[model samples]
Target: MRPINEIIVHCTATPEGRPVSVAEIDAWHRARGWSGIGYHRVIDITGARLAGRPLSAVGAHCAGHNTGTIGVVYVGGLAADGRTPKDTRTPAQRRALAAELMELRDRFNIRKISGHNEYAAKACPSFDASAEYDHLFEGRERLFKPIVDHLLQRGDAGQFAQSWRDQLITWRENRNQPSPLLSSQDPDDLFGHAVEAETLAFQRERQIVADGVVGPQTRNEMRLALNGRPPFSALENYQR
Candidate 1:
Protein backbone atom coordinates (compact mmCIF):
# COMPACT_ATOMS: atom_id res chain seq x y z
CA MET A 1 0.00 0.00 0.00
CA ARG A 2 3.06 2.26 -0.02
CA PRO A 3 2.19 3.64 3.39
CA ILE A 4 -0.98 5.11 1.89
CA ASN A 5 -3.77 6.34 4.16
CA GLU A 6 -5.77 9.23 2.71
CA ILE A 7 -7.61 10.26 -0.48
CA ILE A 8 -8.20 13.97 -1.07
CA VAL A 9 -10.51 15.36 -3.76
CA HIS A 10 -10.63 18.57 -5.83
CA CYS A 11 -12.64 20.09 -8.74
CA THR A 12 -11.54 21.61 -12.03
CA ALA A 13 -14.15 24.38 -11.53
CA THR A 14 -15.25 23.82 -15.13
CA PRO A 15 -17.18 20.97 -16.71
CA GLU A 16 -15.28 21.23 -20.00
CA GLY A 17 -13.85 17.75 -19.47
CA ARG A 18 -11.11 18.94 -21.76
CA PRO A 19 -8.36 16.33 -21.78
CA VAL A 20 -5.38 18.51 -21.11
CA SER A 21 -2.09 16.64 -21.11
CA VAL A 22 -0.07 16.51 -17.88
CA ALA A 23 2.58 18.67 -19.50
CA GLU A 24 0.00 21.29 -20.40
CA ILE A 25 -1.46 21.26 -16.92
CA ASP A 26 2.01 21.80 -15.56
CA ALA A 27 2.61 24.66 -17.97
CA TRP A 28 -0.57 26.33 -16.72
CA HIS A 29 0.58 25.93 -13.16
CA ARG A 30 4.00 27.33 -14.03
CA ALA A 31 2.41 30.35 -15.71
CA ARG A 32 0.65 31.00 -12.43
CA GLY A 33 4.12 30.82 -10.90
CA TRP A 34 2.95 27.92 -8.74
CA SER A 35 4.24 24.35 -8.47
CA GLY A 36 2.66 21.72 -10.79
CA ILE A 37 -0.89 20.40 -11.30
CA GLY A 38 -1.73 19.94 -7.63
CA TYR A 39 -3.41 16.53 -7.80
CA HIS A 40 -2.47 12.85 -8.21
CA ARG A 41 -5.30 12.20 -10.73
CA VAL A 42 -7.88 14.02 -12.83
CA ILE A 43 -11.22 12.50 -13.93
CA ASP A 44 -12.53 14.12 -17.09
CA ILE A 45 -16.19 14.62 -18.04
CA THR A 46 -16.31 11.18 -19.64
CA GLY A 47 -14.93 9.78 -16.38
CA ALA A 48 -11.45 9.02 -17.73
CA ARG A 49 -9.04 9.23 -14.82
CA LEU A 50 -6.07 11.24 -16.11
CA ALA A 51 -3.20 10.39 -13.84
CA GLY A 52 -1.75 13.67 -12.67
CA ARG A 53 1.30 14.61 -10.59
CA PRO A 54 2.84 11.58 -8.97
CA LEU A 55 2.10 11.12 -5.29
CA SER A 56 5.82 10.74 -4.65
CA ALA A 57 6.36 14.25 -6.00
CA VAL A 58 4.42 15.91 -3.19
CA GLY A 59 1.33 17.46 -4.82
CA ALA A 60 -0.05 20.99 -4.42
CA HIS A 61 -3.65 19.82 -3.96
CA CYS A 62 -4.70 19.77 -0.33
CA ALA A 63 -2.87 22.40 1.74
CA GLY A 64 -0.68 20.73 4.33
CA HIS A 65 -1.83 17.20 3.59
CA ASN A 66 -0.16 17.47 0.20
CA THR A 67 3.00 16.57 2.06
CA GLY A 68 1.71 13.06 2.80
CA THR A 69 -1.45 12.31 0.79
CA ILE A 70 -2.73 11.70 -2.75
CA GLY A 71 -5.05 14.12 -4.50
CA VAL A 72 -7.63 13.64 -7.29
CA VAL A 73 -9.42 16.21 -9.43
CA TYR A 74 -12.80 15.44 -10.94
CA VAL A 75 -13.77 17.68 -13.86
CA GLY A 76 -16.05 20.52 -12.82
CA GLY A 77 -16.91 21.66 -9.35
CA LEU A 78 -19.62 19.46 -7.72
CA ALA A 79 -22.55 21.74 -6.86
CA ALA A 80 -24.91 21.05 -9.79
CA ASP A 81 -26.75 24.04 -11.25
CA GLY A 82 -24.75 25.44 -8.44
CA ARG A 83 -24.05 29.04 -7.46
CA THR A 84 -22.78 28.89 -11.06
CA PRO A 85 -23.30 26.48 -13.96
CA LYS A 86 -19.56 25.81 -13.89
CA ASP A 87 -19.89 23.72 -10.73
CA THR A 88 -21.37 20.56 -12.21
CA ARG A 89 -19.71 17.23 -13.00
CA THR A 90 -21.30 14.95 -15.59
CA PRO A 91 -22.84 11.66 -14.46
CA ALA A 92 -20.23 9.96 -16.62
CA GLN A 93 -17.57 11.80 -14.68
CA ARG A 94 -19.10 10.67 -11.40
CA ARG A 95 -19.04 7.02 -12.52
CA ALA A 96 -15.42 7.40 -13.55
CA LEU A 97 -14.61 8.86 -10.15
CA ALA A 98 -16.25 5.92 -8.37
CA ALA A 99 -14.17 3.52 -10.43
CA GLU A 100 -10.98 5.48 -9.86
CA LEU A 101 -11.61 5.64 -6.12
CA MET A 102 -12.28 1.92 -5.98
CA GLU A 103 -9.11 1.18 -7.92
CA LEU A 104 -7.04 3.51 -5.76
CA ARG A 105 -8.46 2.01 -2.63
CA ASP A 106 -7.57 -1.50 -3.78
CA ARG A 107 -4.18 -0.61 -5.21
CA PHE A 108 -2.95 1.61 -2.39
CA ASN A 109 -4.99 0.32 0.49
CA ILE A 110 -5.87 3.97 1.14
CA ARG A 111 -7.58 4.56 4.43
CA LYS A 112 -9.23 7.99 4.72
CA ILE A 113 -11.54 9.54 2.10
CA SER A 114 -12.14 13.26 2.51
CA GLY A 115 -13.29 16.14 0.36
CA HIS A 116 -11.64 19.58 0.12
CA ASN A 117 -14.17 20.58 2.73
CA GLU A 118 -12.66 18.25 5.29
CA TYR A 119 -9.14 19.47 4.86
CA ALA A 120 -9.37 23.22 4.53
CA ALA A 121 -11.83 26.11 4.31
CA LYS A 122 -12.16 26.37 0.55
CA ALA A 123 -14.59 24.36 -1.58
CA CYS A 124 -11.99 23.33 -4.14
CA PRO A 125 -13.66 20.10 -5.25
CA SER A 126 -17.20 21.38 -4.75
CA PHE A 127 -18.60 17.83 -4.38
CA ASP A 128 -19.41 15.80 -1.30
CA ALA A 129 -17.38 12.82 -0.08
CA SER A 130 -18.99 12.71 3.37
CA ALA A 131 -19.39 8.93 3.61
CA GLU A 132 -15.62 8.64 3.38
CA TYR A 133 -15.35 11.59 5.70
CA ASP A 134 -17.53 9.92 8.30
CA HIS A 135 -15.62 6.69 7.89
CA LEU A 136 -12.27 8.37 8.41
CA PHE A 137 -13.35 9.88 11.70
CA GLU A 138 -15.65 7.21 13.11
CA GLY A 139 -13.86 3.98 12.23
CA ARG A 140 -15.39 0.55 13.11
CA GLU A 141 -17.45 1.34 16.14
CA ARG A 142 -21.10 0.29 15.95
CA LEU A 143 -21.83 3.80 17.17
CA PHE A 144 -20.72 5.23 13.77
CA LYS A 145 -24.15 4.89 12.16
CA PRO A 146 -26.03 6.66 14.88
CA ILE A 147 -23.41 9.40 14.89
CA VAL A 148 -23.74 10.07 11.14
CA ASP A 149 -27.53 10.19 11.17
CA HIS A 150 -27.30 12.76 13.91
CA LEU A 151 -24.44 14.85 12.46
CA LEU A 152 -25.85 14.96 8.91
CA GLN A 153 -29.52 15.29 9.78
CA ARG A 154 -30.12 12.14 7.73
CA GLY A 155 -33.89 12.24 7.45
CA ASP A 156 -33.92 15.64 5.72
CA ALA A 157 -31.56 14.87 2.85
CA GLY A 158 -32.10 12.31 0.02
CA GLN A 159 -31.43 8.58 0.11
CA PHE A 160 -28.32 8.42 -2.08
CA ALA A 161 -26.32 10.77 0.11
CA GLN A 162 -27.56 9.04 3.21
CA SER A 163 -26.25 5.79 1.80
CA TRP A 164 -22.84 7.42 1.48
CA ARG A 165 -23.24 8.42 5.08
CA ASP A 166 -23.45 4.72 5.87
CA GLN A 167 -20.60 4.01 3.49
CA LEU A 168 -18.64 6.70 5.32
CA ILE A 169 -19.29 4.82 8.49
CA THR A 170 -18.10 1.52 6.99
CA TRP A 171 -15.22 3.02 5.06
CA ARG A 172 -14.01 4.83 8.19
CA GLU A 173 -14.18 1.62 10.20
CA ASN A 174 -12.30 -0.49 7.65
CA ARG A 175 -9.17 1.61 7.55
CA ASN A 176 -8.50 3.10 10.99
CA GLN A 177 -10.26 0.75 13.40
CA PRO A 178 -11.96 2.05 16.56
CA SER A 179 -10.48 4.76 18.74
CA PRO A 180 -11.75 6.57 21.80
CA LEU A 181 -11.33 9.89 19.97
CA LEU A 182 -14.65 9.03 18.32
CA SER A 183 -16.19 8.36 21.70
CA SER A 184 -20.01 8.29 21.75
CA GLN A 185 -19.78 10.40 24.86
CA ASP A 186 -19.12 13.59 22.89
CA PRO A 187 -22.00 16.05 22.90
CA ASP A 188 -24.08 15.95 19.70
CA ASP A 189 -26.15 18.99 20.51
CA LEU A 190 -24.91 21.16 17.64
CA PHE A 191 -22.01 21.35 15.19
CA GLY A 192 -19.37 21.38 17.99
CA HIS A 193 -16.67 18.71 17.35
CA ALA A 194 -17.99 17.64 14.00
CA VAL A 195 -17.92 21.22 12.79
CA GLU A 196 -14.64 21.88 14.55
CA ALA A 197 -12.82 18.95 12.97
CA GLU A 198 -14.25 19.64 9.53
CA THR A 199 -13.16 23.27 9.82
CA LEU A 200 -9.68 22.30 10.93
CA ALA A 201 -9.30 19.75 8.14
CA PHE A 202 -10.43 22.37 5.65
CA GLN A 203 -8.02 24.92 7.03
CA ARG A 204 -5.17 22.46 6.80
CA GLU A 205 -6.10 21.17 3.32
CA ARG A 206 -6.58 24.66 1.89
CA GLN A 207 -3.39 25.83 3.60
CA ILE A 208 -5.31 28.72 5.00
CA VAL A 209 -3.52 30.01 8.05
CA ALA A 210 -6.18 30.27 10.67
CA ASP A 211 -7.54 28.60 13.75
CA GLY A 212 -10.43 26.20 13.13
CA VAL A 213 -13.76 27.94 13.35
CA VAL A 214 -17.04 27.39 11.50
CA GLY A 215 -18.00 30.42 9.47
CA PRO A 216 -20.17 31.19 6.40
CA GLN A 217 -17.69 29.76 3.86
CA THR A 218 -17.01 26.72 5.97
CA ARG A 219 -20.72 26.13 6.33
CA ASN A 220 -21.06 26.30 2.55
CA GLU A 221 -18.42 23.61 2.15
CA MET A 222 -20.20 21.47 4.72
CA ARG A 223 -23.48 21.75 2.81
CA LEU A 224 -21.77 20.86 -0.46
CA ALA A 225 -19.84 17.90 0.95
CA LEU A 226 -22.84 16.46 2.74
CA ASN A 227 -25.34 17.19 -0.04
CA GLY A 228 -23.33 16.30 -3.17
CA ARG A 229 -23.64 12.49 -3.16
CA PRO A 230 -26.69 10.84 -4.79
CA PRO A 231 -29.67 10.07 -2.57
CA PHE A 232 -30.67 6.72 -4.06
CA SER A 233 -34.28 5.65 -3.61
CA ALA A 234 -33.37 2.22 -2.31
CA LEU A 235 -31.45 3.65 0.64
CA GLU A 236 -32.46 2.49 4.12
CA ASN A 237 -33.05 4.72 7.17
CA TYR A 238 -33.86 7.60 4.82
CA GLN A 239 -36.47 9.84 6.37
CA ARG A 240 -37.36 12.13 3.44
Candidate 2:
Protein backbone atom coordinates (compact mmCIF):
# COMPACT_ATOMS: atom_id res chain seq x y z
CA MET A 1 0.00 0.00 0.00
CA ARG A 2 1.07 3.56 -0.63
CA PRO A 3 2.26 5.50 2.39
CA ILE A 4 -0.54 7.78 3.61
CA ASN A 5 0.04 10.16 6.51
CA GLU A 6 -2.51 12.95 6.25
CA ILE A 7 -6.26 13.52 5.79
CA ILE A 8 -7.60 16.79 4.38
CA VAL A 9 -11.26 17.74 4.74
CA HIS A 10 -13.24 19.76 2.20
CA CYS A 11 -16.79 20.69 1.20
CA THR A 12 -18.90 20.75 -1.96
CA ALA A 13 -19.48 24.51 -1.54
CA THR A 14 -23.10 23.89 -2.48
CA PRO A 15 -26.01 25.50 -0.65
CA GLU A 16 -27.43 24.00 2.50
CA GLY A 17 -29.77 20.97 2.10
CA ARG A 18 -28.77 20.44 -1.51
CA PRO A 19 -27.64 16.92 -2.32
CA VAL A 20 -24.70 16.25 -4.60
CA SER A 21 -23.68 12.80 -5.71
CA VAL A 22 -20.19 11.48 -6.35
CA ALA A 23 -20.97 11.03 -10.04
CA GLU A 24 -21.81 14.72 -10.26
CA ILE A 25 -18.53 15.56 -8.62
CA ASP A 26 -16.77 13.26 -11.07
CA ALA A 27 -18.35 15.01 -14.04
CA TRP A 28 -17.48 18.39 -12.57
CA HIS A 29 -13.83 17.45 -12.22
CA ARG A 30 -13.75 15.93 -15.67
CA ALA A 31 -15.13 19.14 -17.11
CA ARG A 32 -12.27 20.93 -15.45
CA GLY A 33 -9.84 18.70 -17.44
CA TRP A 34 -9.18 16.34 -14.52
CA SER A 35 -9.67 12.56 -14.25
CA GLY A 36 -12.64 12.32 -11.88
CA ILE A 37 -13.83 13.30 -8.41
CA GLY A 38 -10.75 14.63 -6.70
CA TYR A 39 -11.60 13.55 -3.17
CA HIS A 40 -10.90 10.05 -1.89
CA ARG A 41 -14.31 9.93 -0.18
CA VAL A 42 -17.52 11.97 -0.24
CA ILE A 43 -20.27 12.37 2.38
CA ASP A 44 -23.72 13.42 1.25
CA ILE A 45 -26.44 15.30 3.14
CA THR A 46 -27.82 11.99 4.40
CA GLY A 47 -24.41 11.15 5.90
CA ALA A 48 -23.81 8.36 3.40
CA ARG A 49 -20.19 7.69 2.50
CA LEU A 50 -19.66 7.45 -1.26
CA ALA A 51 -16.54 6.24 -2.97
CA GLY A 52 -14.73 8.78 -5.04
CA ARG A 53 -11.25 8.38 -6.56
CA PRO A 54 -9.69 5.10 -5.56
CA LEU A 55 -7.29 5.43 -2.64
CA SER A 56 -4.54 3.75 -4.63
CA ALA A 57 -4.38 6.85 -6.82
CA VAL A 58 -3.21 10.14 -5.38
CA GLY A 59 -6.07 12.61 -4.88
CA ALA A 60 -6.36 15.81 -6.92
CA HIS A 61 -8.18 17.83 -4.27
CA CYS A 62 -5.28 19.79 -2.80
CA ALA A 63 -3.07 21.89 -5.04
CA GLY A 64 0.44 20.79 -4.03
CA HIS A 65 0.09 18.24 -1.23
CA ASN A 66 -1.81 15.43 -2.94
CA THR A 67 0.81 12.78 -2.43
CA GLY A 68 0.55 10.66 0.73
CA THR A 69 -2.76 12.27 1.67
CA ILE A 70 -6.45 11.36 1.54
CA GLY A 71 -9.07 13.98 0.73
CA VAL A 72 -12.56 13.74 2.27
CA VAL A 73 -15.34 16.12 1.23
CA TYR A 74 -18.74 16.66 2.80
CA VAL A 75 -21.74 17.68 0.71
CA GLY A 76 -22.54 21.28 1.67
CA GLY A 77 -20.59 24.28 2.90
CA LEU A 78 -22.76 27.27 1.94
CA ALA A 79 -25.59 29.09 3.62
CA ALA A 80 -29.09 29.34 2.11
CA ASP A 81 -27.80 32.16 -0.07
CA GLY A 82 -25.45 29.65 -1.73
CA ARG A 83 -22.55 32.12 -1.62
CA THR A 84 -21.52 32.60 1.97
CA PRO A 85 -19.47 29.79 3.58
CA LYS A 86 -21.12 28.03 6.50
CA ASP A 87 -20.78 24.88 8.47
CA THR A 88 -23.85 23.08 7.12
CA ARG A 89 -23.01 19.64 8.49
CA THR A 90 -26.06 17.97 10.00
CA PRO A 91 -25.86 15.79 13.11
CA ALA A 92 -25.63 12.65 11.04
CA GLN A 93 -22.95 14.12 8.81
CA ARG A 94 -20.92 15.14 11.85
CA ARG A 95 -21.03 11.65 13.31
CA ALA A 96 -20.26 10.06 9.97
CA LEU A 97 -17.28 12.34 9.39
CA ALA A 98 -15.89 11.57 12.84
CA ALA A 99 -16.24 7.83 12.27
CA GLU A 100 -14.65 8.04 8.84
CA LEU A 101 -11.70 10.02 10.17
CA MET A 102 -11.11 7.64 13.07
CA GLU A 103 -11.19 4.60 10.78
CA LEU A 104 -8.81 6.22 8.30
CA ARG A 105 -6.46 7.35 11.04
CA ASP A 106 -6.15 3.87 12.51
CA ARG A 107 -5.94 2.19 9.10
CA PHE A 108 -3.22 4.43 7.71
CA ASN A 109 -1.59 5.65 10.91
CA ILE A 110 -2.43 9.14 9.66
CA ARG A 111 -0.27 11.80 11.22
CA LYS A 112 -2.40 14.87 10.68
CA ILE A 113 -6.02 15.82 10.05
CA SER A 114 -6.50 19.23 8.48
CA GLY A 115 -9.15 21.47 6.98
CA HIS A 116 -8.76 22.80 3.43
CA ASN A 117 -8.59 26.29 4.89
CA GLU A 118 -5.35 25.34 6.65
CA TYR A 119 -3.65 25.11 3.27
CA ALA A 120 -5.49 27.85 1.36
CA ALA A 121 -7.07 31.22 2.03
CA LYS A 122 -10.61 30.06 1.32
CA ALA A 123 -12.88 28.35 3.86
CA CYS A 124 -13.71 25.23 1.88
CA PRO A 125 -14.67 23.04 4.82
CA SER A 126 -16.25 26.14 6.49
CA PHE A 127 -15.09 25.05 9.93
CA ASP A 128 -12.00 24.34 12.03
CA ALA A 129 -11.77 20.60 11.39
CA SER A 130 -8.27 20.26 12.77
CA ALA A 131 -9.17 21.76 16.12
CA GLU A 132 -12.48 19.90 16.24
CA TYR A 133 -10.87 16.49 15.68
CA ASP A 134 -7.75 17.12 17.76
CA HIS A 135 -8.79 14.53 20.31
CA LEU A 136 -8.68 11.80 17.65
CA PHE A 137 -4.87 11.96 17.58
CA GLU A 138 -4.43 12.31 21.31
CA GLY A 139 -4.01 9.68 24.03
CA ARG A 140 -5.10 9.72 27.65
CA GLU A 141 -2.16 11.93 28.45
CA ARG A 142 -3.68 13.45 31.57
CA LEU A 143 -4.32 10.00 33.05
CA PHE A 144 -0.71 8.99 32.38
CA LYS A 145 0.75 12.22 33.68
CA PRO A 146 2.00 10.70 36.93
CA ILE A 147 3.96 7.94 35.18
CA VAL A 148 5.32 10.39 32.66
CA ASP A 149 6.43 12.86 35.31
CA HIS A 150 8.27 10.29 37.44
CA LEU A 151 9.80 8.23 34.57
CA LEU A 152 9.25 4.85 36.19
CA GLN A 153 11.91 2.14 35.78
CA ARG A 154 12.98 -1.13 37.39
CA GLY A 155 14.25 0.38 40.62
CA ASP A 156 11.11 2.48 41.19
CA ALA A 157 8.59 1.50 43.93
CA GLY A 158 5.59 3.72 44.61
CA GLN A 159 1.97 4.32 43.82
CA PHE A 160 2.97 5.74 40.44
CA ALA A 161 4.75 2.52 39.54
CA GLN A 162 1.78 0.54 40.71
CA SER A 163 -0.50 2.67 38.59
CA TRP A 164 1.67 1.99 35.57
CA ARG A 165 1.59 -1.70 36.31
CA ASP A 166 -2.16 -1.63 36.61
CA GLN A 167 -2.53 0.14 33.29
CA LEU A 168 -0.09 -2.26 31.63
CA ILE A 169 -2.04 -5.22 32.94
CA THR A 170 -5.21 -3.76 31.56
CA TRP A 171 -3.58 -3.17 28.19
CA ARG A 172 -2.25 -6.73 28.07
CA GLU A 173 -5.57 -8.20 29.10
CA ASN A 174 -7.41 -6.17 26.52
CA ARG A 175 -5.17 -7.63 23.77
CA ASN A 176 -5.13 -11.13 25.28
CA GLN A 177 -1.38 -10.87 25.77
CA PRO A 178 0.09 -12.78 28.69
CA SER A 179 0.49 -10.74 31.86
CA PRO A 180 4.11 -10.03 32.78
CA LEU A 181 3.66 -10.24 36.54
CA LEU A 182 4.21 -13.77 37.77
CA SER A 183 1.27 -15.66 39.30
CA SER A 184 3.01 -15.98 42.67
CA GLN A 185 3.89 -12.28 42.85
CA ASP A 186 1.51 -9.98 44.68
CA PRO A 187 0.31 -6.80 42.95
CA ASP A 188 2.78 -4.62 44.79
CA ASP A 189 3.84 -1.04 44.12
CA LEU A 190 7.10 -1.98 42.52
CA PHE A 191 8.62 -1.80 39.04
CA GLY A 192 10.53 -5.07 39.00
CA HIS A 193 12.49 -6.94 36.33
CA ALA A 194 9.39 -8.57 34.92
CA VAL A 195 7.83 -5.16 34.55
CA GLU A 196 10.95 -3.89 32.79
CA ALA A 197 10.93 -6.85 30.41
CA GLU A 198 7.27 -6.28 29.68
CA THR A 199 7.90 -2.60 29.13
CA LEU A 200 10.57 -3.43 26.55
CA ALA A 201 8.22 -5.81 24.75
CA PHE A 202 5.42 -3.26 24.71
CA GLN A 203 7.71 -0.55 23.42
CA ARG A 204 8.98 -2.81 20.65
CA GLU A 205 5.45 -3.78 19.68
CA ARG A 206 4.35 -0.15 19.55
CA GLN A 207 7.40 0.81 17.44
CA ILE A 208 8.65 3.02 20.24
CA VAL A 209 12.21 3.23 21.56
CA ALA A 210 12.82 0.10 23.61
CA ASP A 211 14.52 1.77 26.57
CA GLY A 212 12.47 -0.08 29.21
CA VAL A 213 11.51 3.19 30.89
CA VAL A 214 8.10 4.84 31.17
CA GLY A 215 8.67 8.18 29.50
CA PRO A 216 6.17 10.55 27.93
CA GLN A 217 6.02 8.79 24.56
CA THR A 218 5.88 5.35 26.14
CA ARG A 219 3.06 6.39 28.45
CA ASN A 220 1.15 7.94 25.58
CA GLU A 221 1.53 4.76 23.49
CA MET A 222 0.45 2.65 26.47
CA ARG A 223 -2.68 4.71 26.91
CA LEU A 224 -3.54 4.50 23.23
CA ALA A 225 -2.93 0.75 23.20
CA LEU A 226 -5.19 0.30 26.20
CA ASN A 227 -7.85 2.28 24.37
CA GLY A 228 -7.50 0.00 21.28
CA ARG A 229 -5.75 2.62 19.17
CA PRO A 230 -2.36 2.38 17.52
CA PRO A 231 0.58 4.43 18.64
CA PHE A 232 1.44 7.66 16.85
CA SER A 233 3.93 7.56 14.01
CA ALA A 234 7.57 8.28 14.75
CA LEU A 235 7.57 11.39 12.59
CA GLU A 236 7.99 13.65 15.61
CA ASN A 237 8.98 16.63 13.46
CA TYR A 238 5.66 16.59 11.57
CA GLN A 239 4.16 20.05 11.88
CA ARG A 240 0.63 18.91 12.78
Number of clashing residue pairs in every model?
Answer: 20, 0
Best by TM-score: 2
Clashing pairs in 2: none
lDDT of 1: 0.52
Question: Residue-wise lDDT of candidate 2 within 42-79, one digit each (tens)?
Answer: 88999997778777665668765676678999999999
Q: Relative to the true structure, how large is the alpha-carbon lDDT of every model?
A: 0.52, 0.78
What does the lDDT read for residue 151 in candidate 1? 23
Candidate 2 global Cα RMSD: 16.4
